[model samples]
Target: MDVEFLLKMGRTKGLEGVEIYKVETDSLALTISNDKVKEASASKTFSMGVRGYVGKKVAGVSINDENLNAEVAFEKLSSLIKTSIEDPNWVGFPPPRKGFMNIACRDERIVHADYAEVMKAIKELMEIMKDEAVRNGAERASVVEGMVRLGAQKITVANSEGVHTEDECTVSGIFMVLKTVAGRGESDKSFWIVNRRFDFAELEYLGMNTARLSLMFAGAEKIETGEYDLILTPETFAGILASALIPAFSALNILEGRSPLKDKLESMVLDEKVNILDNPGMPFEIGSRGFDDEGMPTSAKVLVRKGVLKEILHNYYTSARMKLETLGNGFRRNPSSPTTPYPTNFHVQPGESRLEDLQQELKKGLIVYETIGQWMSNPYNGNVKATATHALLVENGEVKGPVKGVLITGNVYEWLGSRLRGIGREVFTSEGVATPGLWVEKVRVAGE
Candidate 1:
């Protein structure tokens, strides 16, 4: 799509300001079921989003047509803008900024990957799962279902304030469910691996670990209801951060009186050992980007320092309303969606203790590797509630056995503050947040 032509057309239409966001994507995906290839497909998609401003009112429209009719799109935007309410604090779009950080977010291997290569990779991954299950003494094992997806996308953003930027990225991911039977008991474990570059090593590790865990959890038992020290694995902690903690840092939420951190800036809110950062400049990670959807340059910033609230995320609108500069966190869910304040590559700084060290130090606790319904946790009040679907009991620094059907409930403020025990040194990224295992004390666990 010709963004320049759209901008020129908007000016001719007498719009004071205009913005165009375009995305072109090509993707290939393969699905496996019953240990057989069930589907293999490829797709190409194009979408254009147009935003126009007239006085203090703004409206936007998104179209999925490859050959977009700009006249129709603009007319629709104009009508919407005319009917919308004006914002007295409405500021024009941001101007372009220079010195966008240099980062490599694309991998040629994934961009050039073929169906044959992807199929071969999945086959190898399945073999690894089967072999690892047998090695772990499983009576029978099978890959019930799986999927592999590869995609490359080009994103372009331009506005009338002389802001224009382009970025390209490649993504590869694999998800699988492995079922293992030991004697009369059966266990099913699911695992996923995603990266900007294709990595067979990571896939191999995921398959082996998942199969072993499935076999070990063949006869999982329930635990007694009691307050226990909890060791949340990296993946588990990342999930909680993405769903519960991070949203509380949005400037939009603060301005609208929806965030708990509204009055806690520059105050200690967590443990002194805890620090968090929003870093979009990290190299080769999935969420890394040089500029956000608003065409503003992105840079690393400290959200929390030594447990003190240092900064809150802001997009163009929220920052402008607050009379502050944009932190480049204004992002859109899609081309058609409005911009919001969101974190890009948000992460907790890793500590020096390893997972093993944390387990040994705790002596007795639950190592939670997976959970269900974590998204149901309340971010507004920091009340966390999730079911531990995959957890193991540790006694005397040794993992005794698998435990399931445990309900974990706690408040994030307390868990990260006084109840915090230790943080693992190894960091892992999952569900867009990077974090290490968190050892929290005296969590309320409900079980049999």
Candidate 2:
């Protein structure tokens, strides 16, 4: 858990530098149902992962037991590192200096939330959503158990050459499915109170909204294929952007020529209004941490500024290869990916317009709320063609009605930079990304 410990141990082993990361998590979860077929249940899980580096030769180990002493774990880790391949491009470790100071990743709610409170909240959400399903004549009414607990006491250690930091956060949420004879629908959403300072009202609203949206898609239909303007809400755009940006920001991908933005630094890559930032201290994100897995201090950097490619995420290995300093984006689920680039909290700064204003500008466009296979869709060419489950037909600057099974196709980068018309001031944070509602022009939509 201590950076100095790892450094001292590494020196004793004749290594130049050492980096260590320890993550301990406790999770409690439950599911419930009132339907005749499905039942309710609850479960709890506790786990810890330890990753260490011996001059770029990395090793990882995980345990469900926290009782094991750190020294024993490190001994096993050191043994494993001896058999690992040396990283030729390794450059010791990242600089251990904090920059652009932000809020520390500490949440009061997480420390206080108990199992009973989590269970009660889950039951409440299930009851509300299930009641709506029953009213719609669902053949089965089921609720998944709710849970509460701190997810991890995530810590990162870097020697004099790398930054070290420690912080803890909480993760808990609920999900359910309502089967209706008219059709089928599933709802999945989570609540992470990492900040604990924020009110729960927004979380409650999100739960209710998700349930209602799922219900709206029951009698969906396909649309005819044709070009149309499209509006993407904050909730829908976050995941899509994550997939696209990850590749563009990945140092390895850039080096391998897999990223289109490679060698395109300072070039326009997005809309002039779009500014993508990485914040390690985002108010309430499970991904928020003081330092990266390789002991690099997390900091905010604009990848795109005024539609220009400004920066790329980097780790020790990649940065060394490129002869650049680590930007502190290095990450690893375990030792296997040490010095790999990954995001902490990717964010898109918002605009001035309101949602209502965005809607008014949508005239003759389709508003896409959700999509399937977004993760599989390619964005390197800036284009996306995928089926949307939740959407609305708009005409004369207003929502006409619900339209389902619509395929929306468009170039993501071009559409956002060129055809992207507006952005709403309302920004929502989810899945480690906070984004605003977006409006894009001339997107191809296919349906009945």
Candidate 3:
């Protein structure tokens, strides 16, 4: 709680430095579908993480109890600290920063929005969908969900370097899911809307569209496969791109010699049309936090600016070990998870053309809507072979019908910069990234 206390403990315990971070979260969720309550849930958690550095060796511990044994935490830390080695690359924590983080994420209405009102809204939305002719065929059809997440978090960082920083903020999130049924065909469509400032109305259209799409997906046909150009929707694009970028953002991956982007600075790594940005200050973005886990000023940055390789996210430890300034990327959930580099809000820039405009440019191609086994795609090798599900067979620049059992295989990099034909307009945003559709000139598509 106090810098002096933590510093004294670190010194008396023969530790190099110390840090304590805490998180308390309260969340509420409601689900309604086909005008019935499918699921309703609420959760609350209070957690803290402690990290002690003894030279090059660092260990993290976390506990759910506020009555955490500081002595025990420190004792265990000291034992691990004993294994610490000295590295010349070690730099201490960042200096005390003086500036207030702009508070863009806050809403009193959400904290006050009653459960009864939330349930009513859920039922109302379902009623609207039902009246909208969404019933195709089904043993049952329903809309599911009303949800709210409201919480406050406080993070305090103090180190032997005389740097002390603390931040407090409130956050709220809302999500809805629409479920459709047609005999044995049951599909679920979801839309997540979250921000500190926005109201439930902001989520209405998204939820409705998701429901509409799910209804349209019924009776989808299997695609006859062959090589075809492709247009990737924003959701599909984000799924593929997040996998590719996750490895590039990992310090452990870089240190372990697994990241291909390692030592690839100042190189044109992507298509010139692409701009990847990760910013903590993006307006209304949920992941936008005031400070990184390591107490560095979390701000907007260009990871890939107009196709040139730009920067990597980092925390105090990785920056120190890597001989670079702390980019505030450190993460340690007590012993719950490993500390490593991860992004706050990763995104690719939007293009000029709309989804239809990009589709018009596609003289002939298939639009792969869903993929199976994407998790198995290798980030290191950038190679992916996925079974394309719910693909749209495009001919002469128009979607004919939904086709199943298509496969799209190619290198992620090739799909990013090489085969990149153009980008589309309709940006579907979530979390912190907003991107429209991505159009690639070619991908190996095999089907019959």
Candidate 4:
């Protein structure tokens, strides 16, 4: 389609400015169950999002039909442009930027790896699970669900501001859940791996780690109710901060008076040892990109340095509204939706303490492997409540037995400031965020 023609039509229709975003994706996925390939699939999707600006009344429309020409898309957008309400803070699209950031998130192997290769990896993972069950004292173990997915996406952004840019990214993901029967009990543990690059060695270790944890969880026990220290494993810790606590950092939430950190800029927000970073230029990290959905160059940034709030992610709209500068965190779930601030390759800087050292630091606590209901956390009040399904009891620097149905409740704001202890050395990435074990002084745990 002729992008120039589309912009000209919008101008002819009296729109002051126009922007177009196009995305194309190709993906392949395979699922395995009971050590056998259950399903294999592949797909491709193409979408275009058009934005028209008539003064402050900006309108966005997206079309998924690849057959539609630029003219048809423009006409459809015209029909809906009337419904757009004038925004209080209306600014024109950005002019062409001088330079681009150096981003290394694409991999040649992942871009070319075939479905047969994924199958081979899945099959090998199954064999490792089988051996884990026998070696770890389980009666039987089977892969409840296993999936490997590879995707390639290219996004192109063009506008009247002479901002024309394109970027390509490839992603690799692994998800596995293992069900094991030990004695008279049954347990399961899941693991996730996602990144731009694939290292089979690391993948294999992580794959076996979940099963090993599940096998250990088969030994059940009960603990007395008390205020004990807490050790959150990388998976649970990352999920909590990435999913529940992230909303606290969103400028939209702050603007709506729904974020606890609304008034916490340049202030101490966490323990002095904690450092948080969100950057799009981290090589091979998930969510790293050269340009955001809003056609802005992304770069490395420090959100928190030594427990003090440093910066907040921003989009063009939020920056203009707040009289600030863009940090290149703009993103829209779809082209039709308004762009907002978001994170990229979010992670916590690890400490020098080893896992054993951190464990020994806690006299009595629970090792939380996984939690449920973390997404429902209230960001405005900083309240966090979740059920620790896969947890282990530790006493006197020793791992006792598994414990389940424990409730972890705390105010994330105050907790990160008061109860938060030291971080571990090893960092694990889940989807986009990378985290290590987080040790807290104590948390309210409901146990028997």
Sorted on TM-score, best first, the list reads 1, 4, 3, 2
Top of the candidates by lDDT: 1
Measured with C-alpha atoms, the lDDT of residue 209 in candidate 3 is 65
* Cα lDDT, model 3, residue 23: 66
TM-score for candidate 4: 0.94
Candidate 4 lDDT, tens digit per residue, 121-173? 77887889778776888888888888888888888887888878898988888
Question: Each model's TM-score?
Answer: 0.96, 0.80, 0.85, 0.94
The local distance difference test score of each candidate is 0.87, 0.65, 0.66, 0.80
Per-residue lDDT of 1-448 in model 2, one digit per residue for the tens?
4447655765675555555555655444344444221333333444445555666686665544444565666677778888999867656656656563555555656556665665556556666666665565554445433333333344435454545566565553434443333344443323233332323565566555554555555555566678888888886787678666556778888887777788999988788888888777776565676667765667878878888888888887788898887567877755434556877888788999986787887778777787776776574654566677778788988767677777776667876788889988888776667889898888878787
Residue-level lDDT tens digits of model 3 in 1-448: 4446756876788776666666665555664444577666666667766667665676666656555666777787777667756555555555655553674554555555556776676667666654442544444556555454555555565556666666655566666556677643766556555555445565566655666666555556665556688888886766666665556756667776878778876788889998877766666566677766656667666888878878887776577677786465555545334356777667677888887777766778877665667666777867776776656677777777666667778877777788998887776656555666888876887776
Task: Give the runs in model 4 whose Cα sits over 4 Å from its true position.
Answer: 66-72, 219-226
Query: How many residue pairs clash in all the candidates, one count each?
Result: 0, 18, 22, 0
Reference-based lDDT, residue 56, model 2: 64
Winner on TM-score (2 vs 4): 4
The segments of candidate 1 whose C-alpha lies over 4 angstroms from its true place after superposition are none
* lDDT for 260 (candidate 1): 86
The per-residue C-alpha lDDT of model 2 at residue 369 equals 80
